[model samples]
Target: MWTLVLNCGSSSVKFALLDVQGGQVRLSGLAERLGSAGASARVEVDGARRVVDLAGGSYAEAFAVIAGALDELGVRAQVGAVGHRVVHGGERFSAPALITPEVLAEIRACVPLAPLHNPANIAGIEAAQAAFPDAAHVAVFDTAFHQSMPEVAFRYAVPGDWYRQHGVRRYGFHGTSHAFVAVRAADLLGRPLSELNLVTAHLGNGCSVCAVQGGRSVDTSMGLTPLEGLVMGTRSGDVDPGLHDYIARQAGLSLSEITAALNRESGLLGLSGLSNDMRELEEAAGRGHAGARLALDVFVHRLAKQMAGMAAAMGRVDGLVFTGGIGENSAWVRGAVLARLAVLGARVDEAANAAAVRGQSGVISAPGALAALVVNTNEELMIAQQTQTLLAEQKGVQA
Candidate 1:
């Protein structure tokens, strides 16, 4: 059976078609800069990439174009299911779910928590469902796996009524990626997941640290929204609540305005006054750019600090797994982050660390290093697995 996975953002959609029999990606692509004149699509198949120019259009149009392309290429193989990466499933969805009308409605209602994300997520899922109506639809939430967190970890120290009535809590983001890497780490180590403890750091444009104890998420960074985690490419993580009011009064900015700045205009780009891409910042820092140097230092500082705390949360780390773009390819970033964890025996073999760059996955630590690993995150594959599981479960019920 094949599964098509979709992760939709505010202005872009990423897709992958996987042949789940062997867990391989048969095709993948992105429709980026959508809803704008500069919109375009890039598809990769058979290890070759082709870019298609797509003018300003809706996600439904993009979906149609993709489906039409697949048909034209005579690659319209029947799919067993479609999995969507919904950003917020609230407290209701604790696992990947086959989408019913009621499930779709619940996703739609959670838009208030993910104002910029859930709408696009729903659009992508609906479009894919329409495009492949015969296929089962599954909602694999980015928030679902982290729902296992304890109340003490997930709760905010706010009024109980606010949490009870407003759904206020720490619903960590990057849960899908963290869950993917943690399981992979356990697999690579040849240990049953329930016997392992892990600190998985997902460092991308957005970052988060997840403490996976016994294969379940015990705690995680990011709270209620993606903006509350570790320092991101442009998001300020863990800022004082009073700063919001203070900045609002001082700058005459509203709460939303402050949030926009933190989520969209801060992080490395804001700190370095250069770029959000870590590669760009690394290059700039190498050129003796003061802000860029400081930005990298600060980024690594916060990232490693959070990793240590997460390790502590798990009591001891069976493995420290790093994933996401920067974590996978940036040896310097990984080395710097690991350097700060020497106290925990997190020693990286420099040679192994360097070789792990460029998407290679392996042990980057010394022979006796207590905990360290580089695992390329495969959220699409994880979503595909979940889709297959749900489909198989449905089949069993019918049987």
Candidate 2:
């Protein structure tokens, strides 16, 4: 069976057609810069690449282009199911769900929790459902894998009524990536996932850490929303809850303005007063840019601190697995984080750390150190697997 995975962002759509039986991507593409000048679509299959203009297009139009590309590649007929990546499942979904009208309504209800993501996800889901009505449609939630978290870890310290009434509590994101890497980390260590404890860090534009025990998420850094995690490219990670009120009173900033600043203008960009890209900050830091140096320092510090917290959650950290763009590629960042974790007996082989770049996965830990590794996260593949499982279950029920 072939599963078509669609990851819809605010302004871009990433897609992959995977052969679930063999775990291979038959085709992949991206449609980006929607509703803006130079909107475009690019597709690659069988080692061939093609790009087409989709200027000033919408998600619906983008999907139309993607469908055309699939047709051109001659794989449209092979797609047996369409898997949609829904960012927030709240406390409702613990696994991938077969999409129906009720399922779509539930997804729509999550828009408030993931205002910036769930709506886009719903748009993609609606578009795909319409485009491929004959095929099974599945909703693979990013929060589903973290739904196993115990109440002690997920509940806030605030009023119980707030959580009970408004559904306000820690619902970790990047669950699919965390779940994927935990299993992969176990495989790399030649151990069963059920036997190992791991602290998995996903460092990219958005960053979060997870503590996994016996293949289940015990604790995670992100809470309620993605804005609560480790410092990210443009999002402020952990700030005092009172800071919002203080800024509002002192600076006369509106709630929306404060939110915009935290979600867009802050983080490395706000701290460095420069680019948010880690590569750019690293280069600037090398040139003795104080802001860039400070930004990197703060990021590494927060990352190490949060990772230590995750380790505490697991009681004993058997291994540390790094994934995402920064985690996999930034040797400097990884080395610095590990250095701060020396008290935990975490030590990385300097040469190995430097060599594990550009998507290469390996054990970067020094001999006898507690298994620090670099693992590439395959979220699309994970979604495909979940979708396939759900579809098979649906078929069995029908039979």
Candidate 3:
């Protein structure tokens, strides 16, 4: 069956059409700069790639362009279903679901918790349903995998009525990525997931750490929002609660201004005074760029400390899986984190770590090194699988 996976952001949409029969992606692309001038769609099919200037105005038009291209390519395979990567489930959805009008409205209502993501995700789902009325549309939430978190872990130490009424609790993000990587790591290690305890570090533009025990998420670093985790490309991860009030009083900055700064102008960009891209920062650091060096150091330090804490929480971290753009590609960052982790028996094989750059899954740990790995995460595939599973269940229910 053919499954099309859609991940929509504020102004961009990423799409992939996967052929589950052979477990291959038939086509993948990104519609960048949507709702802005000079929007374009970059797509690759069978190793052939092309970037086309989009005349479309909004996400709907952009998707229409993509569909037209797929038609041109003669990819006539019937799409069995479409899967969406939704950022928040808000305790309502515990697994992937068939999108109904009520389900779409619930996802829309979650826009407050994910102002920059949920609306776009909802838009994509609506567009797909409009474009392909026959194909079932599924939503696989990023917060779903962490739904296993117990009340003690997910609850905030606040007023009782607040959480009891307002849903004021932890809802970890990056669930799909963490879930995909941890399962793959277990498989690569040739072990049953139930027998493994894993700490998955998803480091990218947005980052988070997950404590996976018995193949289920026991804890995660990212709290209610993506803005709460490890230092990211632009977002400040963890911060002192008092700093907000102090900054407002001292700098005369409004709450919204500070929020914008923390969510958009901080992290690697703020620390490095250069760029948020790790590759650029790494190169600059190599040239004795003080700010860049400091940025890299801080990133690695916080990551190691977080992983160490996750290990403590899990009681025993039998596996460490690193995924995401930086985690899967940056050997220097991985080595630095692992080196600091020697305190927890997490040692790395420098050679294996370096060789892992080509996106191969392997143990980057020394022979005696306590379980460490570099696994490339395929969140789209996970979404597709969830979609297929849910669609099958729907069919069974109807049958």
For 284-318, candidate 3 gives per-residue lDDT tens digits of 99999999999999999999998988888878989
* TM-scores of all candidate predictions against the true structure: 0.97, 0.98, 0.98
Off by over 4 Å in 2: none
Task: Supply candidate 1's per-residue lDDT for 162.
Answer: 89
Flag regions of model 3 displaced more than 4 Å: none
Tens-digit lDDT track for model 2 on 1-399?
678999998889999988877888768899998778878888887668889788667887888887887787787887889988999999889999989999989999989999999988988888888888788999999899899999999999999999999899999999999999999999899999999989999999999999999999989999999999799999999999999999999999999899989999999999999989999999999999999999999999999999999999888989999999999999999999999999899998999999999989989999999889999999999999999888788879999
Error of 3 at 257 (Å): 1.5
The TM-score between candidate 2 and the true structure equals 0.98
Model 1, span 290-399: residue lDDT tens: 98998899999988888888888778888889999988999999999888999888888999999997779998999888768999998999888888988898899999
| Candidate closest to the true structure, highest lDDT | 2
Quote the RMSD, in angstroms, for model 3: 1.2
Q: Per-residue lDDT for 304 in model 2?
A: 96
Residue 220, model 1: lDDT of 93
CA lDDT of 265 in candidate 3? 97
Model 2 Cα RMSD, Å?
1.0
